[model samples]
Target: MRDINVSTEAHILEAAFAVFSQNPGASLADVAKHAGVGRATLHRHFAGRDDLIVALTLTAAQELDEAVETATAHCQTYTHALEVALGAILPLAARHMFLATEPAINDPRVAEVYASQTRDLTHDIDMAKAEGAFDPHVPTEWIVQAYDNLIYAGWAMVAAGDATPKQAAALAWRTLTQGTGNDAPSARNPWHPH
Candidate 1:
């Protein structure tokens, strides 16, 4: 079996995330600094932005899977599990608003990671649909569309104004449900669906 170590993988992602967060256009040199590795070392592990993005994307997928696993570990109802899993991603989604846009900041490789993250998100969207967390008639395509629309809308709100992170999360939640929150949420609750 392939040797998989969460700590090491997380380290790599942390480095990549920091760079992407700081400057979506961050160069490998930037990521190397964040990761505390040499350029050669970074290259040894990831050949380029495309490669690094793919690796980062895979890491994102795995961590999200783990988040769901963690949320679902207690053997509780699916709502409990879904909430836990969603919670993990909510924070990240709330925090990484910029990276979602302008993927070619320092490395166009970011697009790869972006794609990976969306794929994992699609999985959760499926789960939510299956469990009726979403409206029974909520099409998977609509969920995908909602994700794209809401992410940009939410991120713009956070970046443009003095909006707090809590406000950002709430905006994302409300918009995802209704895709119609031009302003911040009326209530600062992430779980309150439209």
Candidate 2:
């Protein structure tokens, strides 16, 4: 409706994601101002707020698909793959965490992408078990669930300001690989070295 240039839509979407991530109830005018575009321009691209939300969800899913592919591209060890995958996905997860509360986030179209990601995670866990990276007795599904939980929890910690993104990633990797148990045979305790 107003200045809807073909090149500006990407800018509008990126601004919308930034706005919505902070304030899910943000108005289209808020998005437009943040995008440095006219309200009508945003409206022309997205008829209403719901349309914009759906578009954001789709964008996040697509980005996540690419991130996963890039993280696993080199066929490293399963633990390394998991570490890189978490590093790649954490920022996206922070942006899209709002999707967890939106009913439309479960749209079948986006669900397909999420399902593919899940399958990839499951396959990686299987590989980890086969390679003795994970405890062989742990079920693949349980490990997959723990991995998913850690990703969510890591982002949650970041959102809460309890940890920086770097610290969160390190915490997730350490917790996943070495649990809280004090079973390691070090001459001195790692947690309380004296």
Candidate 3:
């Protein structure tokens, strides 16, 4: 009986991700249809849409925590860890990206998780800066924001079928380390006056 409850809940969450990722405005009925569960069963697992969103947000946060830990576990440098984390996280975009602008994220529980994630990533960025992997002159907060936005961009590329997750991750890494500029000495910034 417990197993069945857990299975149904998991199925509903999975369907929520699928339906919500494609359309943030999708209703609980859409999730029920996608999961092949009756509306009653869906409501039994989650009282309402906000409840479901919170569940999904918490689930995504837990998954991200695990991915970051596993990805960085064997890394010798924070930079490499960041790259590896990007690889691990890009595939989870469907589970998380939709929540970026969702009001449910303002829930205290979700905010706490997000705060912890920010602190962890900030520490990693500081460590990478110490290793000269990142510019010490730049604000750590800015770097953190850039890193997060890059992840979003990479995920968008993958979601749009413009690139595979691997390709998107590599592009994100390069964009982080190297701006979109010609490296040749003769190449000059057109916007800058000499």
The lDDT leader among the candidates is 3
Q: Rank the candidates by TM-score, best first.
A: 3, 2, 1
Can you tell me which runs of candidate 1 are displaced by over 4 Å? 1-13, 72-85, 94-138, 151-166, 176-194
Determine which window of 10 residues in candidate 2 has minimal summed lDDT. 180-189
Worst 10 residues of 3 by lDDT: 180-189
Worst 10 residues of 1 by lDDT: 180-189
Could you give candidate 1's per-residue lDDT for residues 102-188 as a string of tens digits? 334344454565576677667867766666556545456677777656546655665666555457656666556554222344464
* Deviation of model 3 at 96, angstroms: 3.2
Candidate with best TM-score = 3
Q: Give Cα-based local distance difference scores for all models.
A: 0.60, 0.76, 0.83
lDDT of 1: 0.60
**Model 2 accuracy (lDDT, Cα):** 0.76
- Candidate 2 lDDT at 11 equals 92
Which of the two, 1 or 2, has more TM-score?
Answer: 2
Query: Per-residue lDDT of 106-138 in model 2, one digit per residue for the tens?
Result: 567767766787898899878766766766545
Q: Model 2 residue 85 lDDT?
A: 82
Residue 16 local lDDT, model 3: 91
- Write model 3 residue lDDT over 1-194, tens digit each, in one string: 99999999999999998899999999999999999999999999999988998999998889988987887799999878988998898888766778876767668998899888999899988888787776555667877888889998988888788988889889988887664223423334333436
Give lDDT for model 3: 0.83
Candidate 2's clash total is 0
